[model samples]
Target: MPTVRIPGPPGLPLIGSMVDLARQPLQAMLAAQRDYGDVVRFAFGPPGLRGEIYAVFSPEGAHQVLAGQAANFRKESTLYEEVRSTVGNGLLTAQDADYQRQRRLIQPLFTRRRVDGYAGAVAVEAAALVERWSAVPGGVVEAVAEMSRFALRTVSRILFGADVEAAVDVVRGAFPVLGEYLLARSFSPLHAPRSWPTPANRRALAAQRELYRVCDGIIARRRAAGPGKAEGAGDLLGLLADARTEDGERLDATELRDQVLIFLLAGHETTATSLTFALHLLGRHPEVQRRARAEVGEVLGGRAPGVADVEQLSYLTMVLKESMRLYPAAGIFGRRAVEACEIGGHEIPAGADVMVSPWVTHRHPGHWPEPERFDPERFTPEREAARHRYAWYPFGGGPRACIGQYFSMLESVLALAALLQAFEFEAVDREVPIGQGLTLQAEGPVRVRLTPRSL
Candidate 1:
């Protein structure tokens, strides 16, 4: 048997690499890759932890884990367990047969045809957001929070038929707790249960309950309306509520609740982060922003954008594509091997942890020229076609990829086009820090001054 050799950063006797990661996650990870080559391992957990602790980092390694031989890997149980405690058996947490069944039942709803049906709603909400923001006095608006609110409102309106403007307080109340819980789980060992009476954990549990209550009311209202009434209903909640499996089984109340919670949590947060980053990039690069605004102006002519106009807004799409490439909403994805695999001439053991980082891949020197610069032209049809297929996976690749990608893109494009048409943004602080938890967000609120564009 050939002994496998993987290189990594030096670690202290007890703490290993934990402290390094805590200090500067992106920088530390990049340093590790630089020092240790494409495939690197890092230890975690205390000295006497039951299982071995190591992480593998490489683009090829990431492909092997997430796509090449993905059947042999599962979403790490620890991550899923934490999600299960909060959202129950929704698609995000479920595994094996249950996951398979739910995915099948839900897949058709996110298909191109069904997702396209949501374009009008996305446009309407985006136009409303532009109208409201254009009215705000210029100077230091919190773009991060603003975008988060906008995305939550868009998703809420499409899913629950609830007026997001009315439900803002309720959603805002849940964010801090949810964000903290997810952050803790990402760093802490799974064996340490979240119910250990810590203040943060307690707050998370309370927030979960409150969130459940809000979703429960919406689910109940939808259920009462019956199948025929829901047929033409365009919202995600209605589709899930009224949908039946091939075997004629509907998502029961528990399943429905879990799905709703997942959509609410997963649907809006990432999209918001992406849009916030997109706008920030646009503000910094005036020429790119100018081109995008011009595209929106030519495409829509002062009216709200519709599905038909989305395809013509090429510059806006490129801006979004480049923005996401620089800062993917989910910066990294992980999977654990269930069986041994060989990838890029290295052997991966069954129990190893595999990590693919969009943060790293997007900046890979071999694939992207001047990778650190913001260049939307890289996303032009001709340029994009010539690049590696997986070189720019802001939404990921393969069958298990994000189901809401189309909806997300449509929502983002409409919002971006509308906002750019109505206003111009200037960065109040160019050095605002960014962090990663459930999504990539600014360390503090991103303050930007909004100048309404003179008609």
Candidate 2:
């Protein structure tokens, strides 16, 4: 069989796609997909190195790399590598045997039934957040920062099973620095290596140290509680602390730290970003917000929302789904081919890095009509059923898909619904610049005018 030459722009020698990717990766990838078809070859670094990358735009190719033939690829991308510096072989960065073992041990912690039990606690926090916002004299809220705090609190409580209010504060301060550091490494060709003593590196290192200390404290306190006390407590930390793999091996201290890092950082970060975007979208679209509020009113009848109300808030679910589709919290997914593979009839060489962007694919014209428009109805049951499984994956696809996806979704919907029911939000700006850090976030604080609804 002839090796198919993947189509893409012929850039200047030495540095190929690096400049364009650094400037605006989402736009660059979108254009590559548009001009070069489903499979576009990108030369990011030296011609002979593994830095030469390929972008997969079509659903068929995404499925091949992410799901159907996932084993042929590994989480060896630059993104995961940068993430590993902080997480250190946690589920997100682990591969093969280590990943399988960790996932098996941690899976029960996030089971549907187990996660449902958290809904009440999450709802309580959501209501408390609304109360806090209402107490604001001016009723103007910084949506991203507010959501970050709320998400941090919720995730900290759920994961730690103890009041780590002080620890949450540490995480809040450190997360943005870490996010900016990771994003810079992912984009800039001139980015300093972790070994360098750059100012950003210093900040990232200090932030990481603080986060590691926080994780260690959580683990030590839980361990001090002992098996009986830990097992009796039903939080994620407890479950993980007490968990043993099929072979009866438990995660060691370092492994515990890594898992906490994943849950604390990635877990809270993505949900916070998604909630911010959801609120921004709702604020921009009034009819959608009104309809959503109506659903909440009809369902809750002026009472605080509960776990059982999740099913009843179908329209709010659609709104959240549409928001993710429009501006996915994690915009791009990357994988490295462990073995040569064929995708979209193009031969992908072994060791090549491959990428799929939710920001691009979700807006593909063939998959979404008026792709730029915000239409919650597009997520109606029928339409979703008809679409490709990989077409709208905000949580990603295949075995390596986000384990906390359900938890994040339930948390986001509850928070969004509760807030919308209590207050009407209006965006201060016609356009908000998006910042692509560890996750997608509004570049600056999302300021919104909040008007408390009459119960």
Q: Judged by TM-score, which candidate is best?
A: 2
What lDDT is obtained when candidate 2 is compared to the true structure? Answer: 0.84
Each model's Cα RMSD:
2.2, 1.9
Model 1, residue 432: distance off in Å is: 2.5
List model 1 lDDT by residue over 104-182, tens digit each: 8899988887888877677777877877776777445788888888888878887766434434567778866787576
lDDT of each: 0.75, 0.84
- Residues 1-455, model 2: lDDT tens digits: 87868888776688777777765678788888888888899877556642567889877778888899998888998888989986678988898889989989999888999899988669767988998998998888888889888998998888875554747888888888887778778754467777889899899999999988888877887789887485335777778888997789999889998988888887888888888888888899999999999999999998888888999999999999998998898888799998888888889999888988888889888899999899999989999999998888888889989999999999998898789888999987658877566787676668888999889
Best-matching candidate per lDDT: 2
Clashes of 2: 0
